[model samples]
Target chain A: MKTLTPIEQLPLFTTQIKAFINWTRKNALWPLPFGTACCGIEYMAVVGSHYDISRLGAEVVRFSPRQADLLIVAGTITEKMAPVLRQIYEQMPEPKWVISMGVCASSGGFYRAYHTVQGIQSIVPVDAYVPGCPPTPEAVFQAVIKLQEKISKGDTPSQRLVAKKKMAELTSGNLENTGS
Target chain B: MEYHFQLVHQIKESLGDKAITSVETGIGNPFECVLVVRREDVRKIAEYLKGQRNFQYLMDICGVHYPNREQTLEAVYHFYNRDQKQRVRLKVPHKEGESVPSLTPVYKAANWFEREAFDMMGLKFEGHPDLTRILCHHQFVGHALRKDYPATQNQVCDAPEVFSFPPLPLNEDEDVLTNQRTLVNIGPSHPATHGTFRIYAELQGERIMRAKAEIGYLHRCFEKMAETHKYQQVIPYTDRLNYLSAPMNNAGYCRAVEKLIGIEIPARAQYIRVILNELSRIIDHLVCIGTTSVDMGALTTFWFCFRQRENVYELFEALCGNRMLTTITRVGGVYGDIDDEWKRRCTGVIKTLRETIDEVDRLLTNNKIWLNRMKGTGYVSQANAIDYGFTGPCLRAAGVDHDLRKAEPYYDYDRLEFDVPVFTDSDNFARYMVRMEEMRQSCRLVEQAIAKIPDGPIQVNDPKIVLPPKAEVYTNIEALMNHFMLVINGIQPPKGEIYSYTEAANGELGFYIVSDGTGYPYRVKVRPPCFPIYSSFEETITGGQIADAVATLGQFNVVAGELDR
Candidate 1:
C-alpha cells in the first residue's frame, strides 16, 4: 500500500465545527461514577430511569478514571478513597467538572468524623454541590443541568473554591447558609 | 402445645443437675428454658433436640460475652419446633479457652453460627468442618465481639490456615498446583459486593470451591458506635447498615426502643410505618432481583427493575428528603407526616411501580436465556436450606412457608393483605421468582396501607419519645428546647432488653438492644439476614459451575454493611 498525504481532509467550516463541538459535548460526557459510599446508590438513581440522565446525552458511567469527563462524586469520600479519587481526577481529560451529589460529598453531612474527607473538594475541584445527607435524584438532575449550563456558557470548570469556602465558613462562621 | 412444653421440661429433667435456671415466659410463648450446660454438652444437646425433642429448625444462634461472669462466653441457641410452632432457648456457657463441640454435623446452620462465634468471640468449635475465621480475615487476631476484646487496634496479621477439602489427584503439571486455588478479593470499593464487603474466594478453575466472606470492612463499630450515640442519634447509623432497606433497619431499631420504653405507636404511625416498610421492601427486592439479573448477564431486566426502583426512591425522597439512606423514622415514630404532595407523589409512584413491575416481568420472567442461566445453577435442597437456617426469599424459594411478616407480624403486617410467594426449586430462578412475586405483594400492601391510612397525628402522642414539629420548634420555646434536647441528648428508655425484627427485603432484620437506663444503648446486636446467607455461599455454590457462584451470591442479596455490622 502506498502512503497517502495527510492534507487530503475536507476543509473545516464554522457549521461543521459547531456541529462537531455540540456532538462531541453531547456524545462524550463520560460520567465518572465516583460513588464513594451510600449516596452513590441515589447517584445510580439519577442515571437510572426516574431522572433519566441519558436525556442530557451523558449516561455512560465510566468506572475508570482515564475515560471520564464528568465526575459525579455521589457519596462520602473518606480519607482512604481520597487519594484514589484524586488519582482518578488527575487521570481524567482536561475540562472535567465534578458534581458533589450529596451532603456527604458536599460537606461530610452527618459523617463529619475525623476519618471522613469533610468534602470531596478537599481532593478534587467541584462545580456543583447537591445538598442532602443523600441528595434526591431530582436534585442530582438539577446539578447536572447546572453543570451543562456552565458548559453551554463556555465557562471554565470551577477550581477548588468550595473547599476554601467551606474552610472559611468553618473558621469565620460569617457566611449565610445557602438553601440546602 | 402443653405436650411440647412437657417434652422440653422432660429434656431439662434429662439434663438434671447440668440444667440451670429455666425462666418461663415474660419473653413470650414457647416457655423460655435457660440451660447452664457445659460447652461440651452443646453438640449432645443439639443432637438430643433433633433426635428426641424434634426441635427441627435452628431459628438463631447468638453468642453473648459476659466479661464479669464466671463463664465469659455464652452461646445461646434458639430452636423452633417446625411442626408445633414453638420456640425454645438453649444456653451453654464456656470459658475463654474452651472449645464447644460443633452441631454442624446435625443441623448445618450451626456451621456458620459456630464460625461466627469463633471469629467474633474466639470461641472454638471442635470438629467444625473447615472452621477457620469466617467473617474477619485470616490475619485478624483478636475476636472483636468478646467483652474483653478491644474494639479498636484489632488486626489480622497472617493468612488463615487453609481448610483442607477432599483433595483431587494432581493434574500432572506443577503449575496447576500453584494456580489451582486462585484468590480474588472483591469490594470495599462501595459497589462490588452490595455495601462495603470483601470476599476472599478460593477458586478451583473459575468455580468457587470454598469462598470465605471477609466482612466488617465497613464495620464502623456500629454496635459500639450505637452504644455511645443516643437512641435517636443511632437512627442515622442504622440507615447505613442496609442502605437498600434503611426503613427495615430503622423499624427494627425503633421497635426495639419502643418495646423498652413500653409505649404503643399510634395507629396512623403504624400505617405509615407499614407503607414505608413495604415501599422499602419493594425497592430492596427490586434491587436484589434486578442485580441478580445484572450479575447473570441480563442487562435489560436490570434496567427495567431499576426503572421501577427509581420511582420507588423518588417516593422515599419525597417522604424523607433523602433517597439512599433515609433516616426517616424517629425513636418513637416517623420524623414527620407525609404531606399532601408526598402522598400524591407516593400514589403516583405506586401506580407506576405496578406497571413497571409488569414491564420488568415481561422482560425477564419468561425469557428463555434468563431462565437457562439461573434454572438449576444454585439449587439449595429443602433439607440443606432448613439445615442452613436460610430465611427470607432464600428459604421461601426452598418451599418454606415461613415469613416473619406472617409468622411474627410486626407493624400491622397482620392487617395488611398480601400473599407470601414461595417456590420449590430453591435455585437462583426460584429466588428471582420469589423476589419478583414479593415486589408485587409489597405493591398490594402499599395500596392497602395508602387506602386505609387513618387521619391522625403521624407520631406517637407520647411527647417523651418523638420531638414536636419543626414549625413549633421555630415558634414555641418549649418545643424548641424539646427539639434541642431530643437532637442532642436522645430518648432514654428504662433498663431492659428487647428483641425486635422486621421482614426486610432480604429476610428478617432483627435488633436486640439492651438499655442500662442510659441515653445510649447498653449493647446493640443486629441479626442481619445477609450475614448467615452470605456465609453459606461456599456451601451453596460448591459443586455448581463458576457463573452459578456469582448468580448465587447475587441471589443471596447480601448487603455487606448489614453483614459486617
Candidate 2:
C-alpha cells in the first residue's frame, strides 16, 4: 500500500467530494408515485412521452419507499389515508424530499370536507407545492426542476441532520399541542 | 309520456290501492311521474314490476333527506324496461328508525346501492347480507348526506387498524387440501389496482378461492358538498368523478339541470356536446385498453395510447383553459362556441388518434401472451351481467344490446348514426374488443358531428339561466341587470325531482336531483356506474388465478373517485 500524502487529506478534497455527491444526487432522484386521484393522471402524463420527465432524470418511478429518494404525493389524501402516508414517509430511506403536486394535496383545494385532510403538510413536511386543481404536466415538470435546484444547493450532510432535527421538533410540537 | 302514465296506472291496479299512498304526476317536470309506495310494500312492488311488468333493469337506488317532512328519509329507486323503453321512479318515504326491505333478493345489483344508501343517509336495509359502510371508513360518525350533517366538519382520525381477514378453516374430509392456503392483501396503494383499491384474496396454491374488494380511499364527500353548493358550482365537482371522461360528466350534470328547468339548448351547442362526448369516450377507451395492456406486461402499447391521449388533452386545452378538469359546460349550454380553428385541430387529432389506435391494435390484439392472459380470464354470463346491472361496454360485451343513446336518445343523439358494438364471449378479451370497436364508432360520431354542426347561438336565450356575453353586459343595461341577477342568485329550478342518466364512458352515469325551489339543491345523488360494476368484482375473480385479478380489474376501469363518491 502507498502512503497517503499530507496534501491529499486537506479540506479542499472534502469539499470536492461533497459537491460531487450533491451533483449526482440532484441529477438522479428515484420518485415514489403516491398518486390517489386526478393529479395522479397528470403525473402519469408528465412521465409519458410528451412532457417526458426523463429529461430531468426523474423517469425511474419506484413503487416501494425503500428504493426511492423523492416522494411525489400527487392527489387528495383523506383522513383515512394520512397515517398510511406518514408510515410511507417514515419507511423511506434518509435524505428524502416530498413534492405536493396539486391543489388538493397542497391545501385541500375545493374539497374542504369531513373526509379530506386539509393539506398533506399536516402529516408530513413538503419541500415544493405544485398548485392547480390538478396541475398540468408542464407545472409538474417545473416542480421537479425546483426540487432539483433545492437538491443542488442543499448541504447534503446538513440536510439529513436538519430533517432529523425538524422531525423531532414536529413530534414534540404535536405532543404539546395535543396535550392542551 | 303516455307509457309512463299507463305504467303507473298498471302498478296501482296490480298492487292494491292501499299499497300505494298517492300518485303524483307532473309535480315538477312533465316527463317524470312519482309513485309513493308504503315502506313495507316496496319489495312486493319491485317484484311485481320485474316479474309481471317486465321492468327487469334496476338502474339505481339512492336516499334523499327531507328535513322538514314527517318522514325525513326517502329511498328512491329508478327502474327501466328495455323492451318497453319506459322508465319509472319509485319513492318510499320512511322515518329515521324505519327500515326498508332489501331489494338485493329481487335484483342482485341492489347490493352495493343499498350499502351506499346506508353509508350516505343512514337508510337501513332490513335484510342486506353485507350491509357495512361502503364509501366511508368504518370509524366515520354521522351519515354524510343527511341534511343535519355539516359539510366542512373535519373528522381527524388515527391510522385505521390493520384489517384482518377471518381465518379460513380447511375441510378435513377433503383429500385435496394437503397444503396450507395463504391470504394475500393487494393494495390500497398497489400499482396494479390502479387507484387506491384493496382486495383480499384467499389462495390455495396458485388459484384464488375467494376474493373481497375494499374501496373508499379516495372518497372526497362530493355529494355532501353538492348539497351545499349552487347548481352551477357542482359542474366542476363532476369533472373529478371520472377524470378520464370529464366532458361527459359536465354534459350529464348540465343536461340534468336543464331538464329540471325545461329549456332546450341551441342546435349548435347540442352538436358541440356530441362532439365533446364522443371525444371523451375515445380517450377513455384509449386509457382503458392501454392500462390493461400495461398490466399484462405490454409496455409499448401504453406509450402509444398516451401519445394519443396527450393530443386529445391538447385539444381540450385549446377549447377550455385546463386540460383534464375541463369544466367546459354551463347550465343551459357549453361555456364557449367552437371556432373553425378548434374544429380543424380536433379533426386532425382524431385522425391521428385513429392511426395510433390502429398501431396499438396491431401490437396487442394478436400477441399470444396478451390473449393467454385475457381470453377467458374473468367470465361474466349474460344473465349475471344483467342481474348485476352492468352497463355500457361491460353489458354490451355480455351480448345485451342496450345503449342509452339508441334506446332513449338525449341531446340530439338520435341525429347521429352509429353502431353499438356487442360481443357474446363475456370475458376480459370481449371487453377489450368492445372498447376498441366503440372507440372507432366514437371517432365516426365525432366526424359526423363536426361536419353536421349548424351555425347558430351556443346557449339558450334564457338570461335567467345563462349569463350574457361580457360585451353585451358591459354596454346594455338590461344585459347588465340580467348578468348581475344570474351571477348573484344562480340558476334556480322549480321544485321537482328528476333522475337524468347519460351513457358515460364506463357505464350509465345517472344524477338524481331533488329540488326545493331554491338555488341550492335539496338532494343530489350521483349514481356512479362503477359502483355496481365493482360490486361484481369479487364474484368475477373468485376462481381465476391471482394474476388474472389485476387484468380483470384494469379492464373493469373502476375509477376510485366515482366509485367512492
Candidate 3:
C-alpha cells in the first residue's frame, strides 16, 4: 500500500481535479449554432472577422449537435420547429448548456403571434438569455462570458447524481416541494 | 398620365360589360388606376391584357377580405407594361367559397402568390396546382388575414412527424445497375441555406435528379399583424422582412402610404432616402457575393466583405440607432437627417467598400477554381426567367433590360445617371457579375446623392402626417395638439388603395396598401421579390450537382424573411 502525503490526506486532491476540469470546460465551449432568422445574421457577425468569437475560445461552431457543448438558439423558433430543437438538445452530450441569444429566443421579441413560440425556454432549458431584437456582437460576447462564469462552478459525481435524481423526479411528476 | 388614361380606355373597351364591372381612377392621385372585373372572367381578361395590350409583367397577386361586404373576398392583381411604363390594378370580388381561375397558366410566378392568398385569406383558386397553406403551417386552423381573425388567438399544434422521403422512380435504362436514389435534405437549420429554408434533393450518385424547396419555417405572420398595427407601427415589421436591406423595405412601405396621402416629401428627404437605399443595396450585394464565395470554399473574400459590411453597419448605426434591423424611414419622411459627421463616416465606409470590392474582384474574378465552379452552373433561359417573374439582377443576368429604375422611374431615379448592367448568359457567374456592377452603380448613386442633396427639413411640415418638432411641441399648444393626435391615433390616409413598387436589392419590392380612412390599415400586402425567385429554385437546380445547387442558391440570394413573409 502506498502512503499518502499530509496534503493529499487533507481532501484537496478532489478540489484540484474539479478546478482543472472546470477550467478546461470553461475555455473550450464548442457551440452548436441553431441560427434561424435575423439573429442568425448577427451571429455571423459575431463569428466574422471584426468581432471574432475565437477570442473567447468559442470559434469552432459545429452545425451538428453531438459534438457541441453549447447550444446558441439565435432566432425565432416556430411551433413546427420546437420538436427539432428538443431533439437537438437531447442529442447533445451531457454537461451541455444553452445560451438563448436575441429577444426572439429569449421571449419571442416583436413576433408575438400564432406561429412563433413565446420563448425557447418552453422547449429547452436555457442557461443564459441575451436580450436584443438581434443583439450586437458585443452582447453576444458578454453572454459567452456569463456562460463561462456559470460553467466555472464545475460538476462532480455527486452533483451529477443529484441532477439525474432531480431530473428523474421532475419527469416522474414527483417534484413535491424540494426546497431550494 | 396619357398612358394611364389609354390603359383604362383600352381595358374597358376590350372586356365588355360581362367581364368589366367598373373602372375607378384614383381621385386626387394620378398613380393608381383600378379596374374591377367579374370573378369568372379574371383569367380571360388577364390573358387578353398580356397578349393584346402588352402587359407582359405580372407584378403581384394578393387577396383582401371584407367581412361585411356581399362579396367577402377580393383578389387583386398588379400588371406592368414595360414598353409603355404603365401599371394597372385589377380587382376581382367573389363570395367566400367561389373560386377564381388560376393565373398559373398565364404566368408561372402566380404559383406561390396564389398559394399565399389561399393561406392568408382562405380564397380558393380553382385551377391552381398546389393551393396549400404557404405562409402558415399546415395545421393552422383559420385564415390569418381575414378581418374577423383575432390578433391574440394562438393555437398549440403537435410537432410534425419525421419526414420520410418518397421512393424515387427507377429509370428504364438504369434499373438493372442501380435501383435506389438517395434523398438529401439540406436545410431548415443548415449553414448553407443561410436561414430556415429547406431543400430536399433526390440525388442519383452526384447529380440532383429532382429537388423540391420548402419554406414558411420562419413565417412570423407579418401581413396578419400589419392589419392590427397602426400604419406607422408596421415599419419595424418591415425591417424584419429582407433584414439585410431593411431601409429599402422601410422606404417602399412609407412611399406607398405617402402616395396614398398625396404628400411629396422634401427634396432633402428624397436624396437621403436615395443614399440610404443605395447603401443598403451595397450591403446586400456584399453579403450575396461574400456568402457565395464562402460556400464555394473561399474564406478570404468573406472576411474582406464582412469587414466592409461592418463599416457600413457602423455608418447605419450612426445614421439610425440600429445596425441590422434599422426602421429608419417613417410615413411622411425618414426618422432623422444626415448630419456632416454621418456624411463623413458614410464617405469613408464607401471608400473602404470600394477598396474591398476591388480586392475581392481581383482575388475571385480570374481565379481558376471560382470560374470553374460558377461559369456554367444554374443556367436559366430568358423565357423561363420572365415566366418566373425574375427581377433585379436575376432578370438582368438573363439579358432582360427590365430594371424598374429605368422602366418605371420613381424618387428621382430618372435624374440619377447609373448604368443598368446586363449579361447575355443566365448562369451563376453572370448573376455575380451583375450584382458586382450594381454595387459600383450604387456607390456612384450614393456619391451623387451626397453631392446633390438639397438642404431642407427632413420631415414634412404637415401636422396631420408628421409629428411636430419636440421643442415646439413642448412650448406651443398647436404643436402639442398635433403631437398628441399623431401619436395617439396614427397617420390616416384617405379611403383608397395604392400599389407602389421600389427597385429593392432583390427585385421590385411592391407594397399594395388599402387604407380605410382609419389609423390602422384595412389590408396591407407586400410583394416580396424573393417569393418568386425562390419559387424558381427547383427548376434552377433540377439538373445540377448538389455542390452547384448550394452555389446557385447563394447566387439567387433569397432572403427567407422576405420569401416567407
Candidate 4:
C-alpha cells in the first residue's frame, strides 16, 4: 500500500490536516472592517463599549488587509470602490473569509442606483451575510459566530469555489489523470 | 426680505439687461427671491455680487432638469451674505448643449459645485479650470441626473483610480532632495480617513506641500434614486445622508414636501420635530468628538462619548425600531409620536451625555499632547472660511457667527432660547469647542421643548396630504378610499420647485424639490452641508503635518454619504 498523496480524491490524512488547520483558524480570526458608509457607524458600536466584539476572540481588528483573516465588509460597495475592495481581498494572505454585513454590501440594499454594486458577492466570495439597512450590533455578532462555525466545518464558500474550479480544470479532457 | 427685491433692483440698475433678464418675486413662493440671469453672464454676475454687493458665500450650484421646457436645464445658484442675513437664488436657464460661464473665479467654493453640476446634468461651464466628473466613476458614460438616463442601469467598473495632483513650486532655499517631493495617497479605506475619501498629498519631510482630494467612493446616487420613488418614499434615502443624525434629514425633507403641499402639521408635531432634531444634534456632536479623538489615538474619549452615544441610540430605538437608519418622518409630520417614557429617556440620555462631555472635557481640555495635536494646527482664516462656503459650527468657529437657526430661523427656532457658540481661533481645537458648546445648547433647547410642547394631533388632518388613521380607514368608506389613493398615488404637489433648508447637525441641509404634479418627483437635489466643507479640505491641510490632516478631517465630520451624495 503506497502512501496516499493529498488531493487524490480520497485522502483521509489530508482531511484530518485540513480539519486541524480550520480549527486553529476558527478560534483566532482577526477581522478587518471594510466600512465605507452607515454600516460603519454600526460596526463602531460593535467594537465599542456596549457590544464589545472581543468576547468572540476576533477582537484583533486590523485595518490593513495583510494582517487580517476575516474581512467584514460593513457598507455599500459602489462601482468606484469595487476595484479597491478586490485589491484588499486579494492582499489578505490566503485562507480568508468575508462576511458581507448590511443589505447595502450584501445586495446594495434600497440603493439600486447607477453607482452601487448589486452585491459584494459579485466581487469577493462572501461566507456569510447580515441583513439590515444598517444591521444591528447583534447581527454582526451572529455573523461572526456563523463564520466560525463555517470555518470549523471546513466548508467555507471560498474553499468550495476553489474546489469547484480545481474540478473543472481536472475534468477538461484529462480523465485518465484523475479517474485512473 | 425687502432687501432681496432691492438687491435685484440694484443689480438691474448696475448692469441692466447685460447681467440679469428678469426677477422672480411673488407672494405664492415661500423661499428666497430669484434672479433669472442671462446664460452667458453667470460668472460676471457672480463676481459683481461678491465683489460689489457683499454676496460672499456661494452656498450651492445645482442643475435642475425640465424635459418639456425650451431650456431643458437650469443652473441654480444659491448665494448668502452673513452680515446682512440675506440669501438669494440665481437661475441661469440654458439648453442641453449651451455652455454657461463658470462662477469659480468669484467663489473658490464653486469649483466642486460646477464639477458636480457637470457630472450630474452635463452642464458645461466655460471658464472652469479643471472641470471633470466629481461624483461618478471615471468609466461612467451618461449623466445619471438627467431625465433620460435610466435610474437602474448600473455599470460595473473595476479599474482603480490613479492620483494626479498639481505640483507646488519649490522654494529658493530648498535643496535637491527636498525639491523631490514625495507623493502619497492617503485612503479610500485608511484608518485615519474615517470615511471613503482619498487625499493625494505631496510631502516634503512630513510637511504637506500640496494636497488634493478625490472622493465619491460612497456615491450611492441619492438624487437619482429619489426621483424614481414617491415623495414619502424618499425619506429613507435622506436618512442615509448623514447617518449620525438621520432624523434631521427627515425633518428637512418632510418639511419641504409639507411646504410644497401647503399643509401645516399640528403644534405637537412641530415640538416633537424640534426635540428630535436637538437630540440628534447632541448625538452627532458626541460622535464627531469621539471619532476624532479615536482617530488621533486618544482612545478613552471614544469610549466615554460612544457610551453616551449608545444611550441615545437606545432612546431612538425605543421610538423607532431601527437604531441608526431611523426613517422616523412622514410627509406631513413624524412617523410616530413621542410618549412620556420616550421623553423621560430623552432627558435621561441628555443628562448622561452632559456627564460624558464633561468627562471628555476634563480628560482632553488641558492635555499637553492633545493640545499639540489639535491646537494651532490646520488654521483657516475667516475670509478663507466664508470664501469656501463653510457653514454651521465650522463657519461659526471662524468668527463669522452665522447659524441658520439664529439667522434664518425654521421650525420655530426663533421662539426657542439658546446660545449659538462661536469660536475665533478657527483651528481644529476651536472647531471641537464649538461642537461641544453646541451640544450643550441643544440640550438646553430640548429641555425647553419638552416642557413647552403642546398636546395636539401628531399629523396634519388633511386627507390629501396625510393618511387617515388605520381604524378610520377600516371602518369608513371615504377614509378607506382616501387611504388607498394616498398610499397608491402618493402626495401630488403642484408642478413647481421649492428650496427648503434647515439647520442640520453639520450645517444647512437644504432640499431642492421639483415636482411634476405626479406621484414621483421630477428631480430632488439635496444641498448636503458637508459638500462645501470637504471642497476646502485640501487647502485646510496643505501646510499642516500628515497627522494634523487626520485630526482636522475627523473634526470636519465629513460623512461620505452626504459628501458624495
Judged by whole-model lDDT over C-alpha atoms, candidate 2 comes out at: 0.87
Worst 10 residues of 2 chain A by lDDT: A171-180
Superior by DockQ: candidate 1 or candidate 2: 2
Full candidate order by lDDT, most accurate first? 2, 4, 3, 1
Ten residues in sequence with the least summed lDDT for candidate 2 chain B: B24-33
lDDT of 1 at B83: 61
User: For residues A73-115, what per-residue lDDT tens digits would candidate 4 score against the true structure?
Assistant: 9999999999999999999976789999999999989998889
Q: If scored against the real structure, what TM-score would every candidate get?
A: 0.80, 0.94, 0.93, 0.94
**DockQ, cand. 1:** 0.14
Candidate 3: lDDT of B149? 81
User: Order the candidates by DockQ, highest first — what do you get?
Assistant: 4, 2, 3, 1
Model 2 over residues B100-133: C-alpha lDDT tens digits? 9999999999998999899989999999998988
Q: Candidate 2: which stretches are off by over 4 Å? A: A1-15, A155-158, A162-180, B1-10, B25-33, B173-177
iRMS values in order, in angstroms?
6.2, 1.0, 1.4, 0.8
Candidate 3, what DockQ? 0.57
A36-149 per-residue lDDT for model 2 (tens digits): 998888888888888889999989998899999899999899987787889899999878889999999999999989899999999998988999988988888898888888
TM-score of model 4 (CA atoms):
0.94
Query: Candidate 2, after superposition: displacement of residue B220 in Å?
Result: 0.7
List where candidate 1 sits over 4 angstroms from the true fold: A1-37, A54-58, A63-132, A137-180, B1-8, B22-37, B65-73, B91-99, B122-124, B129-212, B339-345, B469-489
